[model samples]
Target: MPAKTKEQKTAACMALAMKRGDLKKTPGTPAGDMAESMTEEQLVELCGSKVKKGG
Candidate 1:
């Protein structure tokens, strides 16, 4: 499912970056853990289509 809040969408973006090796994954953190446990597709799904370039 898509993220329900901005925070959740942000987290998914961070996780996606980590999963794609674009960002360093800090183990034990929420986004890091999500990156470890979820697939790229899953992260993208959580990120949703409404994401924009800036806030």
Candidate 2:
């Protein structure tokens, strides 16, 4: 599912990174929780679009 908000996109990206071993996952945090619950493919689909520069 695509992210509906900037915060959601950011969280998905962070969670994806955690899943890929690029970032540390801290329990009880949003990104960490997402990392545990969602698959890497799911997180990627959520934030897969190229981010525009400077909003």
lDDT of candidate 2 over 3-51, digit per residue (tens): 6678888988999999999998887998999999998889999878654
Poorest stretch of ten by lDDT in candidate 2 = 46-55
TM-score of each: 0.81, 0.83
Candidate 1 lands at a TM-score of 0.81
- Candidate 1, superposed: residue stretches over 4 Å from native: 49-55
TM-score of predicted structure 2: 0.83
lDDT of 1 by residue, 1-55 (tens): 7566677788889999999989998999889988999999999988775544433
Off by over 4 Å in 2: 50-55
